[model samples]
Target: MKNFKIVFTFVLFLLFSFSNAQKIGVVDTEYILNKLPQYKEAEARLNAQIDTWQSELQNLQAEYEKKRSAFENERVLLVGDQLKLREKEVMDLDKNIKTTTSLRFGANGEITKLRSNLVEPFQDEIYSAIRAVVDKNGLGIVLDKNKDNVISHLPRYDYTDKVLDILLKGSDKKEKTNSKGKK
Candidate 1:
């Protein structure tokens, strides 16, 4: 009787442990970001601004090159005070070109900062949404598809679509109001 009772207790413990074992999942953030419409829009806006800045910089560079070439070609022809004045003009133009180039480069830096600022909030929101999903589902482990390397073969690997759906649904409500005011 003692042996049978001990055996029954062991089986029940095993069943309870098996039932309570954790379920885990992985999410691919890269996949989610790529699919999100808000990310696409931000990328497009940044690209457009970069294109415009590049076009302006190109035009300024062309003008600077023309000035430089003319200064070089005319240097031998001028004499005395005229040469000195021409040299001064060229120096001034060179300084102006340098200043303009620096400003344009600064704008490029600003664009990078803007991209980070825009993307960071979305990243945070997505992470929060992922956490919510994990909590609701009683997940014990949630792995980043970007960081993890040892996933050999899961029956399913991509939670990106589900995460994106959750993110977009939340964003739409808040983003629509913000966008309306901007427009």
Candidate 2:
């Protein structure tokens, strides 16, 4: 079903390209992002935050394990209320660990939220650059090279470098303006 849609889209693209005599361009966004220093920095920051969260989770897991082991060892000596209290403590710790994990790494968790926040600006910048490149070259269709559907395209139609160049130029201008303002 997906393949059929891709083929249909490709056919339509070809029809549009030939019928209108308009150019279709492709871009490798991954390549562009890798070349972007700001994206690299954002990725690094995200990774660092992930590492810290992982460490915290590990510590909680270790504590849970320790308490669980202690509870098992003292099971024979503990009375009804004492055993219940200890079991409750262990269970509470387990619950706390699960909650923490979910809050930090779940589908709608802190990591997902942070990643979206961090990457959104870069996505906007890339989109703007791609739009500018498409407009400047009068391209009717712009396909992402990263998509599996884009099987092959001519080198001439590959506008990845042009988009990256625009992004780099924009950043350079921003840096110059920033530096001038600081001085």
Candidate 3:
């Protein structure tokens, strides 16, 4: 009985030491990005540009629809050569509308480039902020709350709110200093 108790105590001590030696942290990247002023500004700017493009596209569509309705209404009264010429004009307008629609709304190389241009810089900033937090906190491992599949059972204190606060404050200070320098 004495020997068995000694073995059990040693096993318990080993398990406790191993568990206590590990340090883990979690960060909600999505939350941080959403709350960050810089990200919000970038998103707003991109959305405004998209809105402008959409407005222009709407105008073009409206003009094209008006011309189409007029042509359809006048189709019965047209004669031979006049009818052919009018039909040709309608065809040309239809082609112009198709081209413009493709240019404005198509999922193509240009649109991809625009998305990358808008998103890449913001992504870089998020990554930099995360790195800053990790370095400052001396976190052994930082898991992304958004991507951690097994994190549903973890406690809230495992999250690195302190690191996030530091990162946000540091970024704000840097932005203010840069703005002052520019002025």
Candidate 4:
């Protein structure tokens, strides 16, 4: 019985030690993406596109307003087929404006599609970098600081900068390769 108890205690100690060996890391992906110039450029381009779309939408709305006002002013003068034609024209224009707005600004719209296209690559790159960092550091679990509800953590456990380093290094390598290819 004494020998069996000693073996059981030893096994428990080993299990605890092994369990404690795994390291947990936290990464702030948003911070890393903000530091990346490529991501910033992509975001700027998306913003510009959104601005252009908003301007176009505004123009369409102004046109609709103008037509509606004109129709209201000349509504009395228009009679029979003329009145029906003018009303139909205004309704058609309003419908066109709504269609354009929905096509460009709706939930599954052009802007959302373009944003996904522009941002997905960067997100993939960041994910890859995070994976590489985790592997390199032998981290057992990694959490996104932005996504996870992390109340407190040690600075040493924060691997955001390390992930960013990997990304920046990867970019540098690509730049070097591109420059060499150009030469």
Candidate 5:
């Protein structure tokens, strides 16, 4: 189904491309992001967070294993109430670890939220820059070459560098404003 969507989008892009002599532009958002220093910093921060989460998860798993091992070792000698309590403690710890792992790493989890928080502003800026580029170029259709939407694209039609330039210009303007205020 996903492949079908990709193929369909590709077909539409080609169709639109050949339909008229109107200029069609291609923007690679990934390339644009890669050029931004801010994106690199955000990526580094995200990687650090992922590393921390992985270490924390490993510690949790280790703690769970210890509790489970002790419970198993003492189960034979434990009386009714004591055995039940030990069993419950082990079970609860296992459950807690699972929940914590999922909360940190699963879909729509904290890591995902953090990633979005870090990347969304960059994406928005890219989008706006792409729009400005399209408007300036009088583009009829814009296809993303990065997502396999285009099997091949001519260098002439690629507006990624132009869009990146616009994005950088906007970033420069912001920096100048911020510096002026700071001083």
Candidate 6:
């Protein structure tokens, strides 16, 4: 009976201590991004750019294949410096294709740069909106519910709509301000 009382008292004490603590909130960044029109447009533009680059890479590879086949067939027929020059041409074309591919789509390449340029602005806006919500609500912590380790959370604790609201509201305010300033 005494042990039960002690455990019960400890539970009550913990509850009381936590009652005054700052609240925790969760935001789904993907959900918030989806709510932003600019994000959708940026994603579409990035995907289109990626497709164009991929097609170009494919064309380069095809050209390299043709050159390689031609060189293999004529290699035995040619002799001396003529054979060497043709082989060198094929090798240089292959090297140029690899260099182009690396420059366009490799790690830390043009694709990454384009994605950053397109998406970073929306990311910044989302972060600022989340920060504003946290500061205004006196939240102690804000977790991204999109993260893998977050298995479950209460719906009431989810602040995804609040973040979207803030972002949309900010944009609306900007539009209104711009219109008024024009007149």
Give the alpha carbon lDDT tens digit for every residue of 146-169 in model 4: 986788899999999998999999
- Candidate 1 per-residue lDDT, tens place, 86-153, comes to 78877887787677666655656666687788789778978988888887777787787887654654
Residue 70 of model 5, lDDT score: 92
Two-way TM-score contest, 1 vs 5, winner: 5
lDDT of 5 by residue, 1-183 (tens): 999999999999999978867787888888889999989998999999999999988998999899999999988999999999999999998998889888999998899999999999998888898889888989978998788988887899999999999988888998999999999
Q: What is the lDDT of residue 68 in candidate 6?
A: 92
Cα-lDDT of candidate 4: 0.92
Off by over 4 Å in 6: 1-16, 177-183
lDDT of 3 by residue, 1-183 (tens): 999999999999999998777466677767777877877787788778778877877887787788778878998998899888878877887787778667756777345567678678756766676677667656677777788554464665345465558657878899999999999
What candidate 4 gets wrong by more than 4 Å, as runs, is: 1-11, 14-21
Better of 1 and 4 by TM-score: 4
lDDT of the structure predicted as candidate 2:
0.94
Checking candidate 6 for backbone clashes, the offending pairs are none
- Candidate 1 steric clashes: 0
Global lDDT scores for all candidate models: 0.79, 0.94, 0.73, 0.92, 0.91, 0.90
Q: Write down the TM-score of every candidate.
A: 0.68, 0.88, 0.68, 0.89, 0.85, 0.84
Kindly report the root-mean-square deviation of model 4 from the true structure over all alpha carbons: 2.2
**After TM-score superposition, what is the CA distance of residue 120 in candidate 1 from its true location, in Å?**
1.4
TM-score of 1: 0.68
lDDT tens readout by residue for model 6, 1-183:
999999999999999998889798999998888888878988998899899999988998999899899999998999999999999999998998889888988998899899888878988998999999899888999999888757889998888999999999998998899999999
Q: Which candidate is the best by lDDT?
A: 2
Candidate RMSDs in Å, in order, are 5.0, 8.9, 4.1, 2.2, 10.5, 3.5
Candidate 2, residue 106: how far the Cα is off, in Å: 0.8
Please give the distance, in angstroms, between residue 18's alpha carbon in candidate 1 and its true position after superposition.
8.0
